[model samples]
Target: MSRTVFCRKYQEELEGLERAPYPGPIGENIYETISKKAWQDWLSHQTMLINEKHLNMMDASSREYLKQEMQKFFAGEDYDKAEGYVPPVEKE
Candidate 1:
């Protein structure tokens, strides 16, 4: 899918699903929801790749980025805030 189309579709879906992370008041911020939905889509693509290639391999950086992105999302952090947030490096 083209980047532009994917972003538009993902944003529309996120707006339809998901509730506010906090109970006080819901604002215009849609970062967490959008990030989660986008991540899920991306993961699905990766799953397809794994099934097609018969190899359980994914890039370390990409995995790390996803982890951190989810964490920030749950924390109610927007993409701008989460941009600098990186997950701890895993030692094998």
Candidate 2:
């Protein structure tokens, strides 16, 4: 059976991740509080940010920026978006 957690982003209880996303306090904290759904959402959003900003994981600053943005994204705060990205138009 899968575990459940009080999802921080959705503000409700939900199915939790199978394991920590990474090693360390941050990963532990995420494992304890973040739901799988929210984590998936973050992954998609993170991809957008990385692609939009042309971030280089090799650069410490870029990684740090993504870390900060990840925090904001989970906290339901204002987070940066990809540059020059347009939402797909809905078809009627």
Candidate 3:
């Protein structure tokens, strides 16, 4: 059975990740508060960020920017997105 968490991004209780995505306190906090679905969404968003911005993972500042952006994204704050990106409309 999967675990559950009160997802900060979705603002609801949902299935949680099996393990921390990273190996630190921030990862611990995410495991305790973020749902698996939300984390997956972030992964896609992160990919877009990296690609659109040409962010180099080897750079300390790039990693720090991503960390801050991740925090903002999950916190329901205004976070940066790929320039000229238009979110696809969902069909109901």
How high is the CA lDDT of each candidate model?
0.43, 0.93, 0.95
Per-model TM-score, in order, reads: 0.28, 0.91, 0.91
Q: Residue 56 error for model 1, in Å?
A: 3.3
Residue range with the least summed lDDT across 10 consecutive positions in model 2: 81-90
Candidate 2 lDDT tens digits, 1-92 = 88999999999999999999979999999999999999999998888888878889999999999999989999999999876798668899
Span of ten consecutive residues with least summed lDDT in model 3: 81-90
The runs of at least 3 residues in candidate 2 whose Cα sits more than 4 Å from the true structure, single-residue gaps closed, are: 87-92
- For model 1, the superposed segments whose C-alpha errors exceed 4 Å read 1-34, 58-92
Which is better, 1 or 2, measured by TM-score? 2
Prediction RMSDs, each to the true structure: 13.5, 2.1, 2.4
lDDT per residue, candidate 3, 1-92, as tens digits?
Answer: 88899999999999999999988999999999999999999999999899889999999999999999999999999999887977678899
TM-score of 3: 0.91
Ranking by TM-score: 3, 2, 1
lDDT of 1 by residue, 1-92 (tens): 21222133234433322443334423224333444455465455445434543443377765555455544544546522323334457899
Per-candidate clashes, comma-separated: 0, 0, 0
